[model samples]
Target: MGATAIVTRFAPSPTGHLHLGHAHSALFAWRRAREAGGRFLLRIEDIDPLRCRPEFTEAILEDLAWLGLDWDGEVRVQSAHLPEYRRALDALAARGLLYPCFCTRADIAREIAAAASAPHGPDGPLYPGTCRRLSAAERAVRLAAGEAHALRLDMAAALALLPAPLSFAEGGTRIACDPAQFGDAVLARKDVPASYHLCVTHDDALQGITLVTRGADLRPATHLHRLLQHLMGWPEPAYAHHPLITDATGRRLAKRDRAATLRDLRAAGRSPAEVRALAGWPD
Candidate 1:
């Protein structure tokens, strides 16, 4: 591929086996890059040690290869690049764009319940800014005490730093961004040092992904991602949000639902061509 060749990727979390929905997403990204004579990269998002397993990661590679999908370069693993995410969080922290959030799920729920009307965001009720109001001295005391905490973006502060309004290209059109909707979104989780938002945007920029292809369910996340890209001065990539494949019940396919996995389908005598067709792509 040329230096300017289009680059796309299919990043999957190895929390479970490869389902039909996973195949559809992989095929969508692979075809885009392969047909354009560009690069299709594979990334394993195994940052969460508690849920992700090495066996699942290996299974992902096996299933994709079995489905006749080939990618360029060695696969990028998020866990292997912890320092990079730490650098990102450090940069934001230095600028006062990030704050330590010590609130647990139970704490947040109680706070939201107390509020007469809690504002909702794409992810559900927005954070009540409980930790954002912490005094510098108190935050320092907690840090010195080693109290467990997650890092949250100061949404207002981050938006104020933008030189201009943020927007991104989608299907040759510009879509305005509203990142504040994710009030004080978490950048680093309590259990994991890095959050998906921080790692994904950082890796996409690091990998020079010129096109971001994923499910429409993540379109809301694109708004916050654009904000991160602007904050880090990373190049913007065109996005293509595709429709999610749903079961006959009109519910989206999900691993939690025990969706028909590729391995199971293969065991049932399904060929690659048949699986590809089932994934909404037939060669």
Candidate 2:
């Protein structure tokens, strides 16, 4: 935030072993920050306590160290930062930018299927504001009775008050977030502290992330984070969405892609150079 050239972070949720796509993003962020004489940090997005495992987190640190990438300080984990997420959530809620979403996964899926029966992209269904239209009295009635509901940012409410023509750089694509392209994205997982969209925005700014490098598949989300930043009075950083390393089938490698995982490679006696080269990155 001060005189630092730039600050970038590789925040991997330690749910599984680091795979090819993870390596690409890590190298891209590490190189980008280093080239700019900036600080590179590591953050463990372990907010999903249900899925996060300490063993996987340790493996990530080991793999990154093996890859010759170093972070500036002790790793920052999102699970340790719930108070921060809560503070940001409260701030946004006070501003009327976020609303409660009572729809469950199945309910949402049905609504989405109905919408997509007409037409929709791979991003999933548009939230029909089933909860958005709920009056304050109605919401409180449900809340008083102990209803489980996640929080979602009101796209219409946010767009109406915020500036338009929002855009972000995706490799070379000037991907923009039109009001119609995205729906009310969940911010805080109901009952849970923070969702990915909310935490990423909060942590990126709080941790002073200068550049964000992730898979191109998440290109559409840059806009959501961008808008959230503005609403929360957080600074927006430069972003780089790298191409995902995929298999011969054109499927992007994931943690379940066992053959591409660092563990599998290491067990196969693959050197650091060879492992990085698998993602087309230099050792």
Candidate 3:
């Protein structure tokens, strides 16, 4: 394929140190961007000022550079780009696509419990849209009064806007996300203005990214991201979700898991290439 402004990014939050899963995700994006003769970029998803640490962000860069990963130009940090996210939020809110949510974590849990079938994954419980019943006028009144609220997308309306087959190219294969499979995703949290789903989609568009490579676990998320791209009037990029590196117990690597963290592995004498190989990444 010709280089159609093919760009890729590795946007990790500075909440913790870099781990195997992150390594795999970064390597795939870096490799594909190079192979396509496109630009590779790094983005710091550090908007969660409460949990994100400056030390951890610094460590992530050190680890990636140690692994021989190089990114182009100045890095993009979500915290540094607040105006952009707020602009998107305002635009969506203006279109009546975003709703103010007053529900807390416990409130969401009560909803899932009431539903009687709780399924847990890497991203946590699926929201049942408990706060969506509020009228747009009511939502505005609460927001104007300074009541803390999150920004959630109107899923039912958003779905109708997507085509039957949401299409993209991945590893030269045509991939499509069935609109029926994705539910409503919160675009921004009250704790911070940016959610992963929202930041990823908006930042990709903002960065002019055309290709994205990450773990297979995010395969499901691609649909929602694509749906969001359509709703937000942003272009969708080609994506490839590679297999995640699991431990001997078959559990996927986590940033907090000491065994899988690059710092821990490097101390144990594993070469950077060995770390990549163990994660099923190309040389």
Cα lDDT listed for each candidate = 0.96, 0.82, 0.81
Worst 10-residue stretch by lDDT in candidate 2? 116-125
**lDDT for predicted candidate 1 compared with the true structure:** 0.96
lDDT string, candidate 1, 174-259, tens digits: 99999999989999999998999999999999999999999999999999999999999889999999999999999999999999
Query: Model 3 clash pairs?
Result: none
Model 1 spans > 4 angstroms off: none
In model 2, pairs of residues that clash are: 7-210
Candidate achieving the largest TM-score: 1
After the best TM-score superposition of candidate 2, give how far the Cα of residue 109 lies from its true spot, in angstroms: 3.6
- Candidate 2's residue-wise lDDT over 13-100, tens digit each? 9999898788889998888888888889999999987889999999999999997788898889888879988888888899898888
lDDT of 3 by residue, 1-283 (tens): 3648678999898988888888888888888788878889999999888999999989999999999899997999788888888888898778777777898888887789889686554466667867788776887788789999888887777776656657667788987765435445677888988788888889999888888777788787887788778878898788877887888999888866665588988999999989888767847
Off by over 4 Å in 2: 1-4, 111-122, 169-175, 257-259
RMSD of each: 0.7, 2.4, 2.8
**lDDT score of residue 227 within candidate 2:** 81
